[model samples]
Structures are given as C-alpha cells and as structure tokens.
Target: MERGKGSPGKAPRVRAILAGGLVLGVGAAITLAAWNDSDFAQGTFTAGSFNLQGSTNGTTFTENPVGSPATLGFTTNPANLSPGDVVTAPFAVRLDGASTYDATVTLSTEASTGSLAGLTYELTQSEDFGCAETVTETLVTAGQTLGSTPASVTFDLAQGAGTDPGAPVNLCFRVTAGAVVQAQTGSTTWEFAAQSQ
Candidate 1:
C-alpha cells in the first residue's frame, strides 16, 4: 500500500463525474442563447397633379394662361359702340384630362383702359353655350362696373372621370353700356382663378 495514493478505479470515477459536469454546463449555455427572428416594413408616397383649361367655343379647349388670354367671341360686334347697347359672350371652363384634383373657380376683373367707364357687366352660369337673355345661375350680380373687381364669386369644378376631360362649365358674360357711356376704344379682361380642393 502506497501513502497518499487513491485507488485507481476511484480516480477514474472522479474524472468521469467532472467531465459530465462540463458537458452539462456547455448544454445549459447553449439553451440560454435562444433563437431570434425579425420583421420589416416599408411604404411609398407620391403627389397628385392638377390643371385647369378654358374654351371660347366650348369645342376647342386650351390653356389660357396669364399674359395671353383667350378671346371671347361676342354675339354682337364689340367694335361698334352705342349708348344703351348690350353684348353677350359665352366662355367655358373645365379641368384638363390630366388633372387629378377638383377645383373652386373665382371670378375677377382686371384693370381696363379707355371707354370702360360707365359700362356695367353681369356674369351667369348657363346650361348651354348660348348666352341668351334668359339667365340660370347668376354669379356676379347685375350692374357691376367695368374695370372694377367684384366681390368674391366662386364656383366648383370636378375632375374628369377615367382620363376624359371634366364636364364643361358654361358661363355667360353680359355687358351693357350706360346712357352716358363714352364712345371710344376700350379693352377689358376677366380672370378665372382655380384653387384645388
């Protein structure tokens, strides 16, 4: 018997127990590190387009932008002037086929030169292009002085359905000369401003 020496079989059993403990520790560490997964999301954004167009004959529509305006074809010759004379014109407005938004249109008058004094005008929305004596929807009240901007008069327009141009809004402009209206060359311009809604 040797002093301070354990049995060989007992030493082998102790080493086996230590190896088993290390294996268990490694397994517990792997179990603590759990599996993980993730999810992601995204989005896209864009802006819509809008445009407005006008027509004088209600058939040939075009962009009547500022600086160059469409000429209204008056039923009576506007060149000739007489006291107590009245003339009428038909103008149409609508959203272009490419427009994507509806709009509210406001009517206003620009400054005039010569003979515009003592002349009064009225604006009305009509069913047809013909601006007859009969009126349907009065936009600007009668007796609005020429070259003076009237109070805010607004109307609505819808965007076209499926790429076709929106339905036309027919407008009638009636101008009358006062008894004392001057006899000279004059010019007046009106604006139809549209705001998208």
Candidate 2:
C-alpha cells in the first residue's frame, strides 16, 4: 500500500524522506570539517661505542702480539735448559674510544710442549698514565697448573668518569723457572682478554 496523504495508518511522503537525507549529509560534512586538524613533531637519535685494545710492549700498545719462540727463548738457538731464571715482560691495555666503560681483564693459557711443567708465573698491575689516583697494585700467583681457564683479576681497568680517552694500564708479567724443573724443551702461551659490561 502506498504511504501518502492519510489513508489509514499513513507514513511520511517521499519528499520528506529526501529532505531528511539532505540534512544528514550536510551535518556529516560539517562534523568532518570540525575534526580535521594537523600537527608537527620532531626527534633525534645518536650512537655510542666501547672500544678496547692492548699491546705487548709499552711503545707499541696497539694490539697484543704473541711472543715468538726466538724472543721467549731468552737464549741462543736450542736454548739452554735450566732453573731459577726469571723473565719479565711489560704490557699495557687501554680503552680507545670517546665513552666510559666498565670492563674486566682475564688471563688464558696454553701449552705447545710438555704443558709448561715446573714453571711459576706472577702478574702485577700499575697505573701508567691518566689515572686520577693510584690504583692498588695486584699480584696473582698463577702457577703452571691454571691452563685454559679465564682467571679474573681483583682489580678492574675502569674508564674514569673524566673525559679523557686513550688511557693505559701497565702490567708486568714475571715468569720463573721452578727450582726442580726437568731438563727438557717446552713452550707456553698466555693471553689477556678484556670485556665490557
């Protein structure tokens, strides 16, 4: 039945429905315009670093270099076998970067012949340069038995809070032949590794 001028229970006309749709469309467009907006924001980012390096000798503290057989032999070709001989080598470690870092130094050992029998070693530490105050000297009696284990030291080579970079810590390694060492030829290697936390 057509809904038009009051036949019985009549409803709105087509023109009235079209007018309501037009009003709803206009209202929607006005609401959309009110909510439209724009804004501007900005941010920045940067990076940091912690670089560690070391050296075998003082003048060339670049990276640790292994001692050749010719150097560690401490004697001429086919080095003499004996006891009570002490060999000392000086080394230095540094943080070569623009930031401060908390780090640890550990020692590792290996043997190429006879497993370094009948030998004893000592490691001592001191401040070489740029230490704000004296760091207490440390001595560790790393005997011949500590092979391949990372023996951590009591002292830490901390990069001080000050803005100085390229500061070095000096270490003296003393190796002594045991009094009762056997008359045999052997070789051993030791390494120091530094890690940041």
Candidate 3:
C-alpha cells in the first residue's frame, strides 16, 4: 500500500516471507527425525526366551547318553546286541535278548519339523539283555500313529523271553513339561534305536 520511499512490497515482502518460514521449520525437523528413527527401528530384533524342556543327563541311555556310546558311532555292544545286528532308527527304541538266542523287537516313532509342533513330552526306552534267550519277543507291531495337541502320549512295552534269566531290555523316556512346553524352538532332541532280532 505504501509503494516507494521505504519500498513497495517492503524489502521484497520480508525476503519472501522469511524464506517461506525457513522452509517450514526445516520440514518439521526432518519429519520429527524421521519418526523417531522409525520407532527405534520398530523395537528391533527378537527371539530369546526358551523353555524347550527335554533332557537326560544319564541314568541310562544305551545309544544316546548325551556324550558316550561313541556319540552314535556304534561298532556293536549297543548294550551288547548280537543277531546280525540290523537296528536303525530315530523313533523311540527297544530290543532285548542276552540270555542266549530267540529275541525280536522293533520300535518306531518319528516325524516332526520346524519346531516340533504342539510338543508335549513324556518319553521312555530301556533294555539290558545279556545272558539268556529262548524264543520270547512280542511287540512286533505298533508302528506309527501320531497325534499332537496340548500333547499327550503313552507307549507300550515289548521283549519277553518267556520267564527266562535275561532282564535288561529297557528304555525309559520322560518329559512332563505340560502347557505345550511354553517355549522351545530348535532341538528338543529325540533320537532312538533298538536291536537284537
């Protein structure tokens, strides 16, 4: 409105409105420091809470006693097994025959992945036969029938030399974690095998 002596549009309109309000307050402080550095990078990584309950420090585990048994390098004497020795597995195990000869046992229980879904625990496997045998081994079938939920299972027992003098075919697995273990994702380990046929 003045136009001239002091200036029309006072000093170019206050230097273009103070350089557009100093570039809008530095673009709102660079958008609030890029949104607080993206919320500290979305709270950052995770995964450090475990309770995969499953253990056996050793009372007796013929094939897998945590360290010895040649660390699964069987040469024989897998508690003293003899009869062509053709036992292989990762499915709970069992076998007994050491009084003499006439034994047959088979165990099976495998299949699981990622984190062993819906895993509950209570496992058992035992054996110690090394003196008598005479046609006594029943439990040739009960292959595989799995189910998982909150998780619960009951296994059967076999290996009977009909009232002889050979008693050491044993396998005792246990896992009473309950509540689906609460938390455990990796190796709740479960390797097994039984022989003598």
Candidate 4:
C-alpha cells in the first residue's frame, strides 16, 4: 500500500490510460496528408513569312515558285539594232506576303556572248510620266555592260505601308548602242532580284 505504487485494483485503469496516451502521441508525430492535384493547358505558335514578286507589266505579277526563283522576261527583247538606236522597256517589282519589310532591289548581269556587251544601258524609275535615274534616285549606281565581268547594282526598294502585294515600282530600262557600236551578233541575260530586309 505505497503511495507511488498504484493499488492492484486501479492498476488496469491506469495502464489503459497510459496505452491510449501512447497511441495519441504516436498519431500526432505521424505526418497527415490530403489529396493533391494539378492541371495544365497547351498553346501553339506559328511563324510569319516574306516573299517577293516581279513583272514586266504592272498589272501582272509572278510570285516565286515554291521551289524555284521567279523570272521576269523582257516584254520585248531588244534585237537587230543598228548603231545609235535607243530602246526602252518597262518592268516592275512588288512585295507579297503576310508581313511588311524593307526590300532591296538588285540588277545583276548574268552572262552574254556577242555585241550585247558593247551596249550601254541606263535604268530609271518613273512617276507620273517623269523618270529619274534609279541609281541616282535610289541606292544603285550606274548601269552594267553585259560582256564584261559579272556585275551587280543593289538598292533599297521603297514600299508603302498598306500595299498588299505592295504598289508596283515602275522601272524603265533605256538601252543604247553608241553611234560607234560595231555590227556583231550578240546576246545577253540580266537578272533583277528583290530581297526582303
């Protein structure tokens, strides 16, 4: 019958209380968890594009073929010309695509065999029937001789803010055979390329 030792009759109740306390303590130490979830959304992106077009006549433009370059054949090929003869042809360039861009126009001599190399040429941009040297007016300078080493004249193309295919830039080529040009059969090729910036 000591005070520190529980009587035999109360021992079972005390033991039961101690066991319950131990279980409650262990439960408190265990980490509690709840349902967790996450959700996600997907998005897509597309790219823009740039393209150029060329034409001999302002009304008709030819876009570059998907896999090939566009070609602008002279509306009228200059042939059988005598000395002192001057010929002028009209050509045009345009921009076509969803995006707007600064464009560069370049005139490059391809290749030639004959008197065509001896002829001199000048290019002009005309507005309202008045024409100005494209080289002087824009970035390009002077003309090219077909028979000489390959040459290129490049200039920035002017475009309007709202032009869909972009307004056509009217170009005029004045080809002259100097009075002293010798009589010889010759042919030449020239390429005009429009690039986006």
Instruction: Please give the TM-score that candidate 3 achieves against the real structure.
Output: 0.23
**What TM-score does candidate 4 get on C-alpha atoms?**
0.62
Q: Quick one: best lDDT, which candidate? A: 1
Stretch of 10 with least lDDT, candidate 2: 69-78
Considering lDDT, which of the candidate structures 1 and 3 is the better prediction for this target? Answer: 1
Those runs of model 3 whose alpha carbons end farther than 4 Å from true positions after fitting are 1-11, 37-137, 140-197
Model 3 global lDDT (CA atoms, 0 to 1): 0.34
Say which prediction, candidate 2 or candidate 4, comes out ahead on lDDT: 4
lDDT of 1 by residue, 1-197 (tens): 55446576488899999999999999999988887788999898888777888898879889987689888888888788687889989999999988889999988875466767667888899877768736678998889887776688999999999899888899988888776444567888888888999
* Model 2 regions lying over 4 Å from their true place: 1-34, 37-47, 65-81, 98-100, 110-112, 129-135, 142-150, 160-164, 180-183
Weakest lDDT window of 10 consecutive positions for candidate 4: 128-137
lDDT by residue (tens digit), candidate 4, 84-186:
6666666667676444676787776556665564577766675422233333343232354544433456656555566466665677666676643555767
Worst 10 residues of 1 by lDDT: 1-10
For candidate 2, give the lDDT.
0.58
**How much is 45 displaced in model 2, in angstroms?**
6.5
TM-score for each candidate, following the candidate numbering: 0.82, 0.61, 0.23, 0.62
Candidate 3's error at 191, in angstroms? 16
The clash tally of candidate 4 reads 0
- TM-score between model 2 and native: 0.61
For candidate 1, give the lDDT of residue 156: 91
What local distance difference test score does each model get? 0.84, 0.58, 0.34, 0.60
